[model samples]
Every structure is written in C-alpha cells, then in structure tokens.
Target chain A: MNSAAGFTSQDSATRISVGDALTPEDVSASSAVAAEDTARYALMLGDDCLILAQRLGNWISRAPELEEDIALGNIALDLLGHARFFLTYAGSAWGKSEDDLAYFRDEEDFRSCRLVEQDNGDFGKTIARQLIFSFYTHELYSRLVDSADATLAAIADKALKEVDYHQDHAAQWLLRLGGGTAESSRRVQAGLDAAWPYVEELFADVEPTERLAEQGVAVLPSALREPVLDRLHAIITEAGLNPPEAKGAFGADRSGRFSEHRGFILAEMQVLARQHPGASW
Target chain B: MEETDRNAPTDQVPEGGVVTEDPAEHSVWPLWEVFVRSSRGLSHVHAGSLHAPDAAMALRNARDLYTRRNEGTSLWVVPAADITASDPDSKGGYFESPKGKSYRHATYYKQSEGVPHL
Candidate 1:
C-alpha cells in the first residue's frame, strides 16, 4: 500500500482539498496534539485504509461481473479517501505531506493488520475479508466522530457516511453469496473458513494501541471486536450462513500471526518499487 | 427494489402481477424503484432498482447501487408497483382540454417599471 514514488513531491495542495471539494484543512487545524502520538495514530488509521483499499482494488477486472467490479472500485475509492485524511494527519505531525507518508513508508513501517495483507483468493474470500473489515470500520468510524481529536473526529464524521454505505454493500453480498446456490454457498463457507484465522489478529492489543486509546486519539480495536463479531454473527445467521469455526492462532506475535499468504501479497505489492527504486508516472 | 416481486410471499402480491407463486411459496424478493435528489433545487430522478428483503434493505441497496457514483444527495426506494400512473394511451378521454381557463396563461401579466424582471 505504501507508494514511495508518489511521495517524492512536496506539494501540500493535495492534502487540503476540503473547502474546494475534499478538504484536509480540518486536519491541519492544530489539535495541539503531541507530534509522536499524532504520528502513531495517523499511521494506524491510514495504514488500515490503505491496505484495505489495495486489497479491494485488486478486484478490478477480476470480479464475478461488471457490476461487482464497479462496486469494489467505488469501495476502494472511499477507503482511499479515508487513507488520504489519516496519512495527511500523519504528515502534518512531522511537517511533511500526505503523499510523503503514503508513498515513502517501508513495509515494516506500516501499522495495518496482517489480515488486510492477505491475498484475495476468490470471490467468496474477498467478501469474507470485506465482511470482517467493513464491520470493524463501520463501528469504529461511527464512534470516532465523537473522538476528542478534532481532526480524527472530522475525518470520522465524513467517513462514517461512506462506511454506512459500505456496510450495506458487504451485508447484502454476504447474504447472497452465503445463502445462494449450493456452489456459491460452499465457496463462501470455504472463504470464511480461510479468512477466520486472521480475524483475531485485528483485535490483538498492542502497546501503541493502548497508548493512543488513553489519549482518545485511537479507538481500541480489542474493545470493538466483540460488537463487531456480534454484528457479524447476526448478519450471518440472518443470511442462513454458518459462522466459520474459529481457528487457533497461527502466530504468537503481538498482532497474532499473519497467514502464510501475506508474504506473497507483500512481494507482489512492493515489487514495482523494489524493481525500479525511483520510478514515477 | 428489483427483488420485491422475487421476495414477495404468496399473498404479498396478487398472482400474475409482479409476483407469481409455485406451491412451495419460496418467492425470492421484491423489486423497488429508486429515486434520488442531488439538492433542494433538483427534483427526484429515477436512479436504478434493486432486489432486497424489505424496505430497509431496499433503501440500503438503492444507496449502494445508485449513490456510490456520487449521483445523489438523498435517496428513495419504493416497491415498484406502489407507484401508480395514468395510462397515457387512454388520456384522450379528458386530457386534451385545459378547462378553458385563460388566466392560466402568462398573457395576463403586464410589465411595469416597478416589476422590471416580471
């Protein structure tokens, strides 16, 4: 998701398009936040959006149909919008710019969940990933509108509207693919089974998460997981789909363990930059 | 919602009209028409239709299907059949006449210095 090539420029204009169309000025308005704290919070939220956006974008021209292709593209756009806000916030913390943070970061520098980095396996797998991520995002953004951090609050306020639509999109598809023809139902079940192991990693509490949670600059992913899973369960049952059985943690890392699939995804994702260090469009 | 007719149970819609039932009664969903308005100055325009389990799902589907293109500031989804219309082909019975109300024309308005634009 990081694009160092795109970050080479220093233009600040892209960061603050809010008043004209989409504004970053709201983020520029000082919340008087501590620089390091702001950077951590920004990276956390920004990486989440960016990684998810990348995953969804991979569906372009590969979805089951044209409508789904367009739908996933639209969802990716919304997530990219959110990533811009959070990365812009991160940039402001260091007196840099949004593109600087997005395109300049290394893989180790990202704070997104390992689940998001898993490769898209199939249509069912994509929806399974979306069902988990969209539910988490919808609730997180809904609570974040009231965050003490003004910039975070503003970003959340705007994004909550978009996420509301995203949640609906995932919910309907989850129902259809889960409850549809026998073939679809079986694949969707398999998708959820493959995806479920990574879900727990998203909620694993890290020290950075704990620190930001106290500042009201970050919502605790651990605290939100229960409600997220509850909602997921409700939707699955309503759709006549069985919840995938929980798999034991695959990694003992603090974020739990990433699935074996992640290395391949990162390899593909980072290849362009690795191959051509200074490449530009 | 496009699914209305599909989702409607045996009694939901009269047979042979939008919904038909097999003995199983496992009708799919109902279809609803979608409308959207960009702002106060704009009239609601048809966006698209979708199938959903109920009204709430219909609205949600409409929002996803139509508004994701940034086409609307607001949305409305109504069961397609709920919309009533007069048959244009049968309008000859009473549609041609204006009831002879000459005042309905703008010729009655006169321009004056006090009402320059009018």
Candidate 2:
C-alpha cells in the first residue's frame, strides 16, 4: 500500500512518485530561512541512505551466496527509494530536482556519516556496518515519524517500515557469521573492530540537526545513541562476539570534512551522471 | 614439484573402496515454491520459485521477489522436494470422471434459471 499522501493507487502500481507527499507550495509556505535548515537536515539523512545504497548495490553478484545476493539487492533498492524521497523534498527548498542533488554534489558536499562511507571489505565487514547503521536508522526514523513537519513525518513513516526489515537482515547475518565457525567468527570480530570507530560520528550533534530537533522537524541524534548502542551491544554479546572499544572519527558530517574513502566512492558514483548532463533514458 | 605432489595425493582413490562424492558438497541452496495471497478474499496462488538456505530465508526471499510491487498480503513457501504430484501417465484415469459429470454444473439444471441465488 502507498503510505505517502497524494499518491493514487494507479500511480503507486506503475511507478513511485517520490515527491508525492510534498509540493513546492508546501515548502515555500514555510519561512525561507527555516526551510533552509530543514533542507540541510534532509540532506544529511538523504546522503546517508544514498551512499549506503551504492555500497549495497556493489554486492549484486558478489555476495557469498545467491540468496544473499537477492536479499542485499532488495535492501539496496529500499534504501535508494528512501534517499529519493528525502532528496526530492530537500531539493524543493532550493528549486533543484532529486537528480541535481544526488548527481551534482561533490564528496565534500555530502553529509553521510563516516560509517556508511567506509569500504565494504567483505561479507563480514559489510554485515557489521549494516548492523550498526540499520539499528541507528531504525531509532532515528521511528522518532521522526512524529515530526511537526507533515512531509518529513510522512517520509519517515514509510521509511521506518523498510528499516525494520533491514535491521532484521543485518541481525541475522551478524548472528550466523559470528556463530558459524572458528574462522568465520574471527573475521566478523575483526570486521566489528574495524567499523567501531565510525559509530560515534553517527550520533554527533551538529548545529543544524540540533536546531531542527528543537523546532520538532528533526530527530536529535544524541537522543538515539543510548538506546541504539544498548540494543547493538546486546546483539553483539548474544552472537558470542565482543564489542570493540575504539574512539570515534572526529568531524561534523556535511561540513567538507569527511572520511578518506568518500572521495573514491563519489568519483565512481558521479562519473556517469556528470558525464551526461540532463540526460534521461 | 613438492606442492604438486602434495595436491596429487588427494586426487588418488584408496585401494579397494570406491570414492563417493558427497551430494551436498557442490549443491546450491534448495529451491522453494512460493504461493501468495493477493488479498484477504483471495486464495493463495502459486507465484514462482526461488532458492534459499532455509524456510525463514525462503519466506523472506519470496516477499522480496513476489511482493515488491504490492501484489500480496500474505506469502507461503514450500520446499520443492516435499510436494508429490500425480503421474502424467494416469492423468486420463484420474481426471476423466469430472469431465462427464455435467450434472455438477449449474447450467445443466433448467429449473435453476429462475432462481436468483442459484
């Protein structure tokens, strides 16, 4: 069923109109200055999902098993859908389309957390990253469903259901890889350790996010940290794996300071879109 | 030469006993037949098949593949090997009787023409 407003059943069947929930008028009605902050907040969320979706797409033919291949592909498609909605709504404020926001942005302009920009080293490493990110997204979206902004609330309401499945997918893989064999357990443990340093940056409270949270238009990242970490630690312990104690990467997301790997990811993703301007199939 | 010699021993069969390959060794995940209920009033119909490691994964895979377009409210997955079917050779004997039972059809009863709920 289509959850977003203004989407007819016919439109939902044939295609997804990502911007169905919000109109240009709705965005323009809000104060232009406030709209800018909301737009920036939306960009942070949109960039996170967009980058992770690209990472997940890389596993289409490369997952360890065929079932996992399809599973990851489905999750990637869902994340891409979420990214499109957020980007479209965010773009409305600046008179830009979803494609403009996604394709034209440089690596420094992206607001994705360091965790999502990290390399998907192996199945184990990818699962470790998915586990942390999905749990955090689950909490974030759950709270955002009640945002004062109707458009943001609608987008979050739809995205929250999909994130539930993503969390389950990552949790299942984490359990299996952690409990499977001696070598498997060792690799996944190492994967968790490698990804642990990036976790804290996801909950870092930046100025825009803080301002938006106060206005009831965005979820406070700091508020999600305790519950998300508590749930993640329990799962890690249950899987017979130890949670890593590492310092977080220091920097505000979307402030031109990004993880080292973000540049390479952006270069590959934007190459085609940048080469062919205003082109569509 | 030593590395090649070390691998060669594994390829050799032991004396007297035949070397049997494990059937599960080279097999992928088992295939599952998927059925989906489009809505509350509809019966579950066979949708398609997919490969998964277990029942839980099979169900999840079916949901992703079949219901991505909002096609179904419920899903069922059965291991392909568990289903038993009638032999094609016995199709005439098994299904012939129903063909000749014209009285079972509503159209065969002339008196039912005037009945509203018939």
DockQ each: 0.09, 0.24
Q: Number of the top candidate by TM-score?
A: 2
Prediction 2 global C-alpha lDDT: 0.84
Per-residue lDDT value at A145 in model 1:
83
- Measured by lDDT, the strongest candidate is 2
Consecutive 10-residue window with the lowest summed lDDT within model 2 chain B:
B2-11
lDDT of 1 by residue, B1-94 (tens): 4455655557556755664445236664667899998667989988777776678767766665776544677888888779897887878766
C-alpha lDDT (0 to 100) for residue A31 of candidate 2? 48
| Tens digit of per-residue lDDT, candidate 1, span A1-281 | 12232332233643311222235554655464436776677677778788788788989999765556777888898898899888888887677766566665655566777667767888887888888888988888888887778777888888887888788787888888877889888887787777788788777766576777887878887898889889999998887788877864666232314445444555666677767766777
Cα lDDT of model 2 by residue, B13-97, tens digit: 7644566666357777788999998778989999999887779878988988888777778999999889998998999999987
How much is B108 displaced in model 2, in angstroms? 3.6
What are the per-residue Cα lDDT tens digits for candidate 2 across A1-281?
A: 24333445454554523333333344434443228889889888999999999999999999887768888999998898888878888887888877898999887788888888888888999999999999999999999999998888878888888899999988887887898899889888989999998898888888698988988999999899999999999999999999998888667454647577888888888899999998776
